[model samples]
Target: MVAGPKVVHQSMPVLDVQYRCVAKGIEETVDISAAAAAVAVVTPPSSPSFRPASELDLRESDAISDVALDVNVLPFVPSIRSGSYSDIGPRRYMEDEHICIDDLSTHMGSLFKCPTPSAFYGVFDGHGGPDAAAYLRRHVMRFFFEDTDFPQSLQVDDVFLEDVENSVRKAYLLADHALADECTVNKSSGTTVLTTLVFGRLLLVANAGDCRAVLCRKGEAVDMSQDHRPIYAAERQRVVESGGFIDDGYLNGVLSVSRALGDWDLKLPRGSPSPLIAEPEFRQALLTEEDEFLIIGCDGIWDVMSSQHAVSIVRKGLRRHDDPQQCARELVMEALRLNTFDNLTVIVICFSNEQQDSSPSQQQPPVLRCCSLSAEALCNLRRWLDDDRSN
Candidate 1:
């Protein structure tokens, strides 16, 4: 990989201090001290009443053939976060949400016919315009699977994690550029992205903006992504240095999110800081049979529900014999019912198996598509998935 721009390191008092907060029912919030790191509060649910995936009685139908674990995506979206606001900026009164569940996913399953009994899914919440989310729907998966070091054969090794990280970084940069290109109607628009990739027993998640990815293993809900807010230490420092100040909880007194893609209006060069970056904070987990599925969505859903509450709603729906897609749809629908005014997108990918011819020559290498093929060409075969509808 070629060395790119040097990152300006942030050194501040906030980097070393850990703050704690106590709320009545919720556990105390914890602060992270690193500028390049995350401050997260992970509170275990109070009740053992939380169902574990292993403990839940599995319906006979839940069992599938070994091949069924290959990978299949199911997802849903809501027109608006909440109905109260007839208009959210110039976008629309209804929430402008976008989501995708592509069976022909990229990144994790590029070498094989499908992901290894694992699934990949994501949700994009467009803020300035639909361009950002639309870009992720077409690009994030390719980022994860692009590294030359990515193992062609599924073997757990340190290299696996490295590849994952590198891919995420590449994806973020590529997505940012893709959205900024003049191909879109609103090239300066931006969106938040939350995605999950499940490979065999490992789950790698990444996010930007306030979009979130939550996991329910056994029955407890676990946060797998960080919310980037202006109040965040690193974000605050960047804002201040860039000559911007937070006012009323937003970056530079404007956007509510700290990091996102395609905010050209925010990425100005002569700024207190470049509009907050869209670099994603990532988490990796080793999946087990206990991991049923995952949920990825925008802030609209998170605003009205906690991770536990969201998981419970989806879990109940799954128990009622809803498929992954149906579960996702229900979550978004319920979010709208609860009065969320932002766009809502949700994706649920249940691990399934599919047949594949493993002969080395028979394997099809993955292909990536881009407007200016420079980024995509460096990695692998570039294939344009988007049309040149210059509208």
Candidate 2:
């Protein structure tokens, strides 16, 4: 799950829920429509729910020009709150992994002069085996704060924020390196990593592979991470340059993702670089009252749901009862109803004070995007890739 921060200054206002799965399984090619219904939203009877936006509308997501900063806009930011749960969809064992840490930034603050109590969220979707995913879940926190060149405390300056971004980049690689160096985990195992770090009003996101992070701003979905598939133009170039070829959209006829953590078996010997990698892309956003929630999930949820559909569902849920956890449950159930046959894990983080006691909607609503396949799907997808080696 990708996630929040606390405000040190005066009052401003603001807002997630969890869902758990019972069965488990590995990779599969999915049709989201078959796994979930169309994107729908529920609003107060007086206020009509908006239709789902077919595409992400991020024109104003990162700009302060869109926000009206006034006396009504309190310096007091919404407290970061998070909830999460995992499920085994159609398999025997669950390989998806996640974390939600509200005190991560705060604990790291001990190293700096000022304490910036931030939150951390991540979702790891594993392939080959669960070992790599499990390892990331256990050690991600260390890889992020200890291994990377993070500052003692966060400064609101551009340079320091850049440092934070670099640290985040290094952290992802470190985790991959640790997995490669470790003997207990499988050498062929791999996983997609999607994480979010919230410091005050700043939200930073990093991604490797297909797990995704989506933010809800004013009931609209804004993508924080893009999928790295071998078929993508730049990603295909990297794979080809690094001596990997794509066949039928699969990397070297084996891996589906162009970038990822672990999968040591896919690389060359003597530290020679392999086409597959653990490097991550990043995005930054400024939080405002209009920003409502964040969703960090593996492919299972995205397999069946659209970003706007997910946002609409959560928004409608909050509009009614304001419970992030229950909203998560509804989304998972929706996927199951539609038939997403993969291990599912979702983390929901809220930015508003909307989850207090509330009423129910006379009508119901809709659900994030990530591309993770099941183990069986991975095997089948592998059969579609063509691996040719020239040394």
Candidate 3:
């Protein structure tokens, strides 16, 4: 196993939590103790318990085999650097919100111990209003890390990955219920969420609705999330089976997307099997040297460009400037240029430390020019040349 911090759970009687929120191009830190407390009190759905390696019975030889296999065969852990940017686009008000934590260990502080090189990112696209997205942005830390009973382990193995995926699923469902319980948020407002987590070499992406995550490996785009639209075959089948109809491509002739959190107006009576769902689809990958970066964006970005097109833009931008922040801005600007109809949000996460030069130098060919000269100037030049020759 990779030598790193040992994972352990610790409770904090008093907590000081800080998160970065970006709104209208301005970032602010807000305290959400009340919201976090609300999340903490609500228990997550029952699932398999996440047991540490020490608790499991294993032979001494098995431990040695695991260590040898991991150290010798596993790929190197990525050095992550991420940045995000958002734009209102042509919309009157922005309904997209996002969060990026490059170092989860530092952000979470003493509440829990996380695997090395841990990071978390999420994008919430709100409809009906901005309340749902804003609410999720504020309470994301608690819902995903604290309330979900997330797994903790020093090794990134199959067991650990499975537990983490289960924890993330529970977190999504819990956040959906929490939205319904919050009195301040509108019952009709809902948001499509897409979240990505990075632990050492493992990268996990969970998505709902139209938001997408694309991984760039060796200059190629690898889609990590599928768009859950009412018109899609799988989603359409689900909606029909759930007694919901699709009219003009809208779910139940109401919402455009098939899955989302909140919208209690549709999912009313508390878990009665509605077409609209909060459950997310997951995708994961093992990071290697070929993996260059990851791009997560709202529907606005994807609606105007293909996954490969977006990856090419970001790859070119990174090579030109090696700045993830600038790459995110470029994506938003490009989407605007394409005349996207909704709010735009994008996050660019780079995996390596190597910095490329901004531009390459090239030698210019000699210029051939012809110009008219005065007779007197020409005569003087000739005389000077003659004098130099004579000397």
Candidate 4:
């Protein structure tokens, strides 16, 4: 076992005080605060309700015959107070990639022809190999900003919104096309991308494959993106329409996701076009005072935790440690604790709200617990099931 370098903890920043409503019902209005105590985000819980893995979606992965947890991922909870902040925690995937591109303070935004100096966050979960995910992470921002009609600045007009959407669409497609064109990249390698762009209070989330984005508006969990899995109704319909078969929920008996970047090798269609596509779907939101934090994670985390469950964990982490970075690390650790079989990566972005006081007292956070099957046993079961089906 090798020791990994220590992670530098965040020195809690003195956040500029902002306003948050004391009122409970914001169903009538959109503007709100991110502070957990000030606003009634979700039916002001009597006690923080943190459920385990059984309540949310779960996907069984190949069981591990040899499982060893890395010690480098030191377990620590950290936060960045005041303003917008982000953190990442990686767990056991050889191919998962996360990028935080914040150019707000630099002239890079203008140089890239972007309209705003907003930060970009992406989590790419790679399959087959790391090439596809790594490629997209390196070039996502370039494609997003270099394209024609990218936003110059914030415009209230609907036309500009359309243009921004178009730019994102073009960027995603271009990235996909680029992967297909790259001779060195393995055509068999593919990746699931979940990217979030923050412009002031507006959040534009683009998604492909199963990586998920969830916004903790107040205390309530709000889904910012949808998973594109092979078994999904719409996804299945499209696969069939494109002359693809889903053998045991696998796309054409090969991939599990219906949409992703790369997979040129799987583009071989019996009669129709390729079953896999790189086009991403978009979701937009206007952040308010009540929007506490947003989470972008690979399927490994979501497989064992619900949107609300993940939010509950982050909110509790913030209340106790007040650190988004630590909160992210905790999330990955929690998933690992639950015995997840896939790679894990989770990002938590907190929006700073107007604080009521200079030094806020730390609050006691709720406790949580979960269960999981050993990787070896699960893998054995999966193989047995597969053999049974095949025979």
- Ordered from best to worst TM-score, the candidate numbers read 3, 2, 4, 1
The residue-by-residue lDDT of candidate 1 on 283-340, one tens digit each, is 9987654555567777777888888887887777666654566677778777777887
For model 3, how does the per-residue alpha-carbon lDDT over 1-391 read when each residue is reduced to its tens digit?
A: 1222222222232335433333343323322232233343444434455333223222222211112122345457888899899999999999999999999988888766767899999999999999999999999999998899899887889999999999999999999999999999999999999999999889999998899999998889999999999999999999999989999999988899999999999999896989999999999999888899999999999999999999999988877777899999999999999999999999999987435221234222221111222233233333443465699
Q: After superposition, how far is residue 168 of candidate 1 from its true place, in Å?
A: 1.7
What's the lDDT of the predicted structure labeled candidate 3?
0.81
Q: How good is model 3 by TM-score? A: 0.72
Candidate order by lDDT, decreasing, is 3, 2, 4, 1
CA lDDT, every model vs. true structure? 0.57, 0.71, 0.81, 0.67
Model 4 deviation from native, Cα RMSD in Å: 23.9
Judging by TM-score against the true structure, name the best candidate.
Answer: 3
Off by over 4 Å in 3: 1-74, 354-391
C-alpha positional error of residue 381 in candidate 3 after TM-score superposition, expressed in Å: 47
What lDDT is obtained when candidate 1 is compared to the true structure? 0.57
**What would the per-residue lDDT of candidate 2 be over residues 9-109, giving only the tens digit for each residue?**
12121101111222222111223222122112211133243222222122222212212223343454657887776788887788998888876745555
lDDT tens readout by residue for model 4, 1-391: 1112322212222322222222232111111111222222233233444333223222233111223333566421212232122223343347888876554425353354433436778888999988999888877767877654467655434676677778887887788878888988898998988888776556789998999999987799999998998899999999898788899989989898989988878864322377788888999987655678888888888888899999999888777666677888888888877777788788888765212222344222211111123333233333443465699
> Between 2 and 3, whose TM-score is larger?
3
What local lDDT score does residue 363 receive in model 4, on the 0 to 100 scale? Answer: 22
